[model samples]
Target: MQNQWLVAYTSPKTEKKIYGRLLELDIDAFLPLQKVTRQWSDRKKVVEVPLFPNYLFVKITQQERWKVLSQRGVIKFLSHGGVPCSVPENQVRAIKDLICEQEVEIYGSSSLCKGERVVIVKGPLMGFEGFLTEKKGKMRLVVRLSSISQSISIEICESHVEKIYG
Candidate 1:
């Protein structure tokens, strides 16, 4: 079977640990990390934390699924109707690209601003769809995939996107 990107649910606060275990087993995995400041009694410290809590992405074939599940921290594959669902390559790539962006923001579905649907007409993320939200005179494209329950906002040129009607 061909290799596909699958989402793996892990134990609480075990995303980084599971990512490491997958790597040791020669499995390709991704754990998106973002920088945030944490407050303490004495001082505040900046740290890199998992962008998606308790979730990790892994690239593996059908034959390799069991190997990943057998790992200590992994709970199970995210499945629908008793079958593992594969994430589209474009969506996965978009997430990776978002992580590398300097002017990027991540938000849960509840907080996304309302706007017209749009697609990137040009640039590396061409064809990505999401609600367009503007803040402080800066235009951004917010991409939300309901299946993932997470949204990403990336700064884009106003001319590079066009409104799309449903």
Candidate 2:
């Protein structure tokens, strides 16, 4: 079977470690991270933290699924009704492109109600598709990563995106 992107749930705080292991084993993986300024009692430091906690995306064929599961930190692939869920390539590409911008926010998939489907037609996010939402009186584009029940929202200009009509 051809390789497909699957979401791997990992042990808490082990995302980076498991990602490294996947890399060492020559398995293709993606772990989205964002740089944030963390405050400590003594000092402040900027660190790169996983955008989606406890989740990593792996590209593998059906036969390779077991190999991924054999890794120490991996719990299992995200699934529905005992069947592994594969993520669309376009969504993955949209995420990679979305992270290049600085104002992204992560949200639990359940928190936001579905809104209008839209595709960015201008600016850096051109061609990225997501739902249009309004929060705190500002419009944002929300990209839902359904396999893992998480979504990422980025504030966007209304002119930058157009509604996707049926």
Writing each residue's lDDT as its tens digit, candidate 1 over 50-89 gives 8878889999999999998998888888888888878887
lDDT of 1 at 91: 76
Q: In order, how many clashes per candidate?
A: 0, 0
Q: In model 1, what is the error at residue 36, expressed in angstroms?
A: 1.7
Report clash pairs, candidate 2.
none
lDDT of 2 by residue, 1-166 (tens): 8999999999999999999999999999999998889999999999999989999999999999988899998999999999999988877776776678654432434433348788878655577679967787655787666667898778765666677879
**Which candidate number has the best TM-score?**
1
TM-score of each: 0.79, 0.77
| lDDT of predicted model 1 | 0.78
Q: List the residue pairs that clash in candidate 1.
A: none
